[model samples]
Target: MSTGYDYSWFILTQSIIKKEFALSGSEQNPDLTGKSWRMTLRRATNKGAPAPVEAFKSHGVDFIVRDRIEDLVAEMNKLAGNDLLKLEHIRMQIEARDREIVNPYVKDAQVMNIHNARRYIGDRLIRTAAPHRILDPAQGPLIAVKLNILTRKTLGGFETDLDSRVFGGEGSIIPGLYAVGEAAGFGGGGVHGYRSLEGTFLGGCLFSGRNAGRAAAKAVG
Candidate 1:
């Protein structure tokens, strides 16, 4: 989802139309068969990753390391249990993206964005990595991580007022019931609308909790 392309990692999604993996079973007993994403990064890039090198190796089934692109592709395909990705296609894409890194005034949107982000002191020092060719032998020992899509949070919940009181079926306040934070739909059900901004949920949660606590204290007093 992040398109900043800071050259930290190369993300590739499986062809949705070309494949139809199983998705049967209940939420608690759900099946996760044949679902994976290919995320490749060079040795230098991996060093900058939040997790340490040992963590990736310990990640069983989801982690892969290879010194060569050809071998990397082969392992990736073997992991997927099918020939979903072609070595040539993957090589060409990486090569094209790498070519844009050499040009300071490159027209590539992703590369340009990465450059722009690196302009910030904080990003340059920690978050963003300097542009580099992903396939460069100097940055050898390519790493591939098989990622899975999972829901971490919900953006929708019960409609509530400023005081965090839940609304009844007829839109009136329901006494003795207060839904705050995410339960009250993240900032009283209207602050974020349909799509909420990332990293802003904590503020919403605190605000809603403060209001709910204050209102509850007043009601009891």
Candidate 2:
């Protein structure tokens, strides 16, 4: 769903349950449920390789590389063990996006966002890629990264007081019970309130931990 310079590109599949994830085997298999794959396709370059790509490579994560789009699509299908992604469908989408890039006025939200991000000097210099067609021969050979989603943190948690004391169902603090950091819901249960800015949770965790430590120390004293 997001794209950046050589370092960042993310695409989240739209439907949680789709035909792409359905395996040929029995539906009774527990492992088959809720399984899906996300892929990032980018132009291969010697320079400006994304840090994650390097790290992943060093850690032995497999990467698909091909000189031709057809070859790339074939590899992707081979890896997925399914013919979910059609070469023509992928080509059509890429060509459509490329066409918008050449247009003086673009209506694509993602392309517009990319342009908007580049207006900032920092993003322009390091975080955003120059708008280009992925199919451009000069940009090949292409790289495909298969991604897996991992749960990092919870946005919501136990409701707590400023001192990190856990609040009960009746809205009373439970004796000798406390929650801190993410357990205190990042910042007492509604600090993020359904959404949060990246890296802000660290601050909330630290602040809540500090409050809990002080409060516990004072109470014990």
User: Which model scores highest in lDDT?
Assistant: 1
Compose the digit string of candidate 2's lDDT tens values, residues 59-154.
534456666878878877787677877889888987887799777799888889978988986556444666767677665556665665455677
Best model number under TM-score: 2
Cα TM-score per model: 0.65, 0.68
Ten-residue stretch with the least lDDT total in model 2: 11-20
lDDT of 1 by residue, 56-107 (tens): 4446576666768888889887877778778999899888888998887799
Error of 1 at 192 (Å): 5.5
Specify the poorest-scoring 10-residue window by lDDT in model 1: 13-22
Q: What lDDT score goes with residue 69 in model 2?
A: 74
lDDT of each: 0.63, 0.61
Task: Provide backbone clash counts, one per model.
Answer: 0, 2
Clashing pairs in 2: 1-10, 1-11
